[model samples]
Target: MAAFLAIIRRDLRLALRQGSDSLMVVMFFVLTVVLFPFGVGPETGVLERIAAGVLWVTALLASMLSLDRLFQADYEDGSLDLITLSPVPLSLLVMGKVAAHWLTTGLPLLLAAPVLAVLLHLNQDGFLILIVAMLLGTPTLSLIGAVGAALVLGARRGGVLLSLLVLPLYIPVLVFGVSAVDAAVMGFEVRAQLLVLSAMLLSALALCPWAAASALRQAVE
Candidate 1:
């Protein structure tokens, strides 16, 4: 318990001290949201209609921006080798990192949605669903993204390649996340969509770390 907390604390402190990564992710989220008003023109109806999709898409891209950092620094400093040799299972350690990543990136994006809700003219009811759906859905992004980050740990053009590998997988999250908000707007129960999002998170939690761990092992070989 202590070692896991220690690892989580260590990563969280590192992420905080070196703040650019989290800041950049929030900036990416904000910038992408800001662009939609211009690209789609100033129709509140149009913005409201598409806001859920736009928000999810921006979050997906912002999360992708941070993926390269997951292991890149450790790989460069040889600390990743030591992590692999540690008494703690690498998958647990990876989960700690993912937890920290969610705190720094995913949680912040969720926090920022209210401001963005205003920007996108999201209805109050829809705003709740958008935030709740993302709360459940974005952890799944971080989990799956950890796999892509680990897979591309040493690959050239890894950023581009990571997007290709993960974006298709992201579709279901976005689809259902947006659908939840849209359903809320139409006065339907969004609990079903929320259930689906939670299910996706659970599935990713069960599956992604092993894939990420396998990729990390291969990266170090």
Candidate 2:
């Protein structure tokens, strides 16, 4: 337990020291969503209709921008080897890093969503649903992204490879997250979509850390 907390604290402190990663993610998310209105034309009805999808897609892309660095820094500096040799299970330690990633990246995106939603004129229900869905979904993204990051460790063009490996896996979260907001906007019950989002989160939480830890072991072997 102490090791898990220590790992989390270590990653969080690293993130704080190198603050640009989180700042860049938030900036990319905001800029990407802001561009949509200009490209699609400023029609309130159209913007409202597509707002949820736009936000989710942009957030997914923004999250991807930081994933390449998830393990790359530690792997390059031999820190990953020391981490693997730690008494803590590698999977639990990996989960700590994943948690820090979500806290730094996902949480800011969640906070920024409302401002973008308003710019897109999202319905009130959709606004609320947007927060709820992102809350449930983004942590799952970080979890799955950790696996991709670990898998591509030390590979050339790892960012490109990471996108290919992770984007397909991200589809389910995007689909359900957008659907939940859309359902709420349409006055339909969003319980089912949120439930599916919860299920995905639970599934990712159970599987991704172990997969990532295994991949990390392979990378350092």
Candidate 3:
């Protein structure tokens, strides 16, 4: 328990010191979402119709921006070897890293989503549901991304490879996240969509840490 918290705090401290990683993620999210208005024109109805998908897709991409580095820093500095050698379970350490990643990346995206939704003319009725869906979905993004980050730890062109490996897996989260918001906007029951997102999160929570840890072990070996 102590080691888990320590790993999270250590990563959080490193993230705070670097700062640019988190800033880049938010900037990418905001800029990408902002571009939609220009590309699609200023029509409110059109923006409203596509807002959920746009925000979700952009957020998904933005989340990917920092994933390749999730373990690369530690791996490069040889800290990962020491971390893996620690008495604490590697899976728990991976969870701590994922939690830190979410705090720095996912949480910002979650907070910024509602504002961008407004810019996209997302229906006000869907605003709360958008938050709810992102809340359930973004952590899952980090969790799953951790595994990809771990898997591609030493590969060349890892960022591109990470995207290819992870994007397909991200589709379900994107689909359900957009669906929940759209359902809310259209006065449909959003419970099912939200439930599915929650289920995915739970499943990721259960499996991703262990998978990422296994990959990390192989990377170090």
* Cα lDDT over the full model 1: 0.90
lDDT by residue (tens digit), candidate 1, 1-221: 67778877988899999999999999989998999999999999999999888898999999889988988999999999998888988888888888888888999999998799899998888877888898999999999999999999888999899999999999999999989999999899988999999999999999998889888999999
Model 2 lDDT tens row, 117-209: 999999988888899999999999999999999999989999999999999999999999999999999999999999999999999999999
Q: What order do candidates take by TM-score, descending?
A: 3, 2, 1
TM-scores of all candidate predictions against the true structure:
0.97, 0.99, 0.99
RMSD of 2: 0.6
Off by over 4 Å in 1: none
Cα lDDT tens digits for candidate 3, 1-221: 99999988999999999999999999999999999999999999999999999999999999999999999999999999999999999999999999999999999999999999989999999999999999999999999999999999999999999999999999999999999999999999999999999999999999999999999999999
The residue pairs that clash in candidate 3, if any, are none
Count of steric clashes across candidates, in order: 0, 0, 0
- Whole-model lDDT for model 3 versus the true structure? 0.96
Between candidates 1 and 3, name the one with more favorable lDDT. 3
- lDDT for model 2 comes to 0.96
Whole-model lDDT per candidate: 0.90, 0.96, 0.96
lDDT (C-alpha) at residue 203 in model 1: 93
